[model samples]
Target: MKNVFTTLLLFSCLISAPSITAADERVKIIPDVVYGHKFGMALTFDVFQPEKPNGAGVLFMVSGGWYSRWTDPQNMLSWFKPLLDEGFTVFCVRHGSSPKFKIPEVVEDVRRSVRFIRLHAKDYGVDPSRLGVWGGSAGGHLSLVLGTTSDKGKPEAKDKVLQESDRVAAVAAYYPPTDLREFVDEKSPYYQRFPALQFDKELADDFSPLLQVTPDDPPTLLIHGDQDKLVPISHSENIMQQFKEKKVPVELLVIENAAHGFRGDDQTRASQAVVKWFQKHLAKQAD
Candidate 1:
């Protein structure tokens, strides 16, 4: 009887599944476009462009917990629909995963990816100067890095892409660790968790966005949960303060009673905030 019931349920689900067609999908996607080559691997990104673009682009950092992974654009359609609906082209940027490539190398890969995007912005129908970045957690750290550590391209580099600025005009991140060394000390629990990071002042400062903020850094919006334990709220608080001191445009939205990742209505609110942020900072006129 148990087997018969399970078989019937599976059959019902199969028949009840909604039939989806190409026309039903609103956004158009170009998948697995190689943006950079490193470590004998082709670093790629999936691009999702709205039916009508707003002439701006967003590099959505595809990372979490400091371990990089690729997410199918279809799987993230709902999560990114808000941006697409607002007419922004979204690039799902993937980097070399950690434990294989250390955090610093992953940072370099992300920087290279941004340069590639800016170099080919015309082909992607985006204004190179109006690009933005968005991510959370480890991805958020990289997003903050892109915002703060951007520099003029090496004019002498043989690769033309390397000669394009990696700077972005806007950034939005959620619950990101802005400082690494501050989290890992002799008495901290995270000291054992991020062994690859190597708790030293120089390396920490290299990876910590808090140490890199400048007045030229892009307009940034940070949404962090007050109750986040994995990455303390202080990380966002400290960076936001630093941005303020530098006279950079920044905002922090603290979600009350929320943890590392916002849930339910808080998550929805966070997503909405990201859209509004990019709209303000990445607008065509802002460029």
Candidate 2:
């Protein structure tokens, strides 16, 4: 009788397991959709649309160490499958790489991408007001900038896309450098790496998301490893403090003993946290 009960329980559990449907798959991929032209180079993005969408979209900034590069959409499809599983559309946003474009120019490119996405939200089957952004390292820094900066559209702009606000509804980033001015000392590698930003306090502050936090900024989630040698955990801590002071919705997760880029279970945990954050913040709320 006991053996029979165990067999029945196992069968029940197997039957209850979630089945993979066609709607759970990423069915559409639109590559190299040009969002802007800069320095005679085209700024493009790739959209990964799920077979079943939740009316929300996420923009993933494809940047690392201040250098932006093109990434194969298939390579990132697995990394973003969690978001896809939840029926969220994903966009891989690419900006002009550094050394040729500089940080400020990269910032503008990202902002423009956000505006472009918002302008065409309906065509993409996403709610314009329900967009989120996420990234790691330099991409994370740019994501924070999108969270904090809000601009009224220019009425005279030639492109209608430029007239949409660049603001994002939610943000999630991993180990981002929030303050450029804080790392301007002679001993800091970031100071030497980006020489163009040195001695320019105004420009540094302009790019610093820590300095840009406002009361009306979008909800934000930051995840950083406690033992991160490249971008310290204090970066997120300081920014979290600013977010609190300004009454912005923010949360910081510090992964114990993890490094700059999370590995093993730490990476999984960070990714899961990001998925939940967007799920909560990007949901369409009643007015």
Give, for candidate 1, the lowest lDDT window spanning 10 residues: 7-16
lDDT of 1 by residue, 24-56 (tens): 297889999998887788999999889899999
**Candidate 2 has what TM-score?**
0.88
In order of appearance, the predictions have TM-scores of 0.88, 0.88
Worst 10 residues of 2 by lDDT: 7-16
Q: What is the lDDT of residue 176 in candidate 2?
A: 87
Q: What lDDT score is found at residue 76 in candidate 1?
A: 65
